[model samples]
Target: MNCEQIRELLAGYQDGELDGAQHEMVSGHLEECADCRAELAQLDKVKEVTGKVKYNDLPLEVWEGYWQGIYRRIERGLGWIFASVGAVIMLITGAYYLVKDYFMDPAVALFPKIGVGALIIGGGFLLVSVGRERIFAHNRDRYKEVQR
Candidate 1:
């Protein structure tokens, strides 16, 4: 067999997978061809090197670092949730008192109540707009995951 044909059969020959005739043919070609012998030698070296490789777990510090990052994210998320809840409760209570003590009182002028209502509505819209813009920008930011 030629070098190409023998090269193709070299792996099967190495593994003893070829039938007797093909094995002998490749063996004869390998014996005569220096290039084929070198090719087979390289293949053997690669197989040996890869076969000796073993998997090992990462160090304890590595695992700890990963868990710490996860825990920090969870803590910050919970803190934000609690802070937002507290702010909402405070806003609702303040609005209730303002309406009960001033808006519902007959002594308060009409213009002042209208001004306060407009201020509250305007502030709420601005807050919602800023929040939506932040969320939109966050969603569109391409470099969010890139650390400096």
Candidate 2:
């Protein structure tokens, strides 16, 4: 067999997938061709090491429940998102009306108005600080790129 044919069939020969005629032809070529023999040797060593490698096998039930677990987590996440959005909307609406009324009322005390303004500013600063911290933490998370 020529070098091109031998190279094409090399993997099949190594895996014992070649028929009797093809196997004999490849064997004869390997005996006379030093390059093909060396290549075959490398392929054999790789196959030997890979063959000895073992995989961790989980139970059948674990595999069956895997999708269910993922689905439940996604469901819970969506529910929490909806609930949180609704709560934020209500809080923002309430705060907007309260602040509007406070500012519009000329009879309201100045000290109380200042206190309310300080509280709003403090809450905004806290929210921004927490959001920035969370973004930095997520960027630094080592397993963030890992597949679930």
Best by lDDT: 1
Q: Output the worst ten-in-a-row residue range by lDDT, candidate 2.
A: 52-61
Best candidate (score: TM-score): 1
Candidate 2 per-residue C-alpha lDDT over 108-144 given as tens digits, one digit per residue, 9 for 90 to 100: 9999999988998899899889979976885666256
> Against the true structure, candidate 2 has what lDDT?
0.84
lDDT of each: 0.85, 0.84
Q: Which runs of model 1 end up more than 4 angstroms from their true locations?
A: 1-58, 137-143, 146-148
Question: Candidate 2, TM-score vs. the true structure?
Answer: 0.45
Clashing pairs in 2: none
Cα lDDT of model 1 by residue, 1-148, tens digit: 6788888998998889999999989988888899999999998998787765522244666778778978986997798699889999999999999989989999999999999999999999999999899768855662564352
Clash counts for the predictions, in order = 0, 0
Report the error of model 2 at residue 22, Å.
59
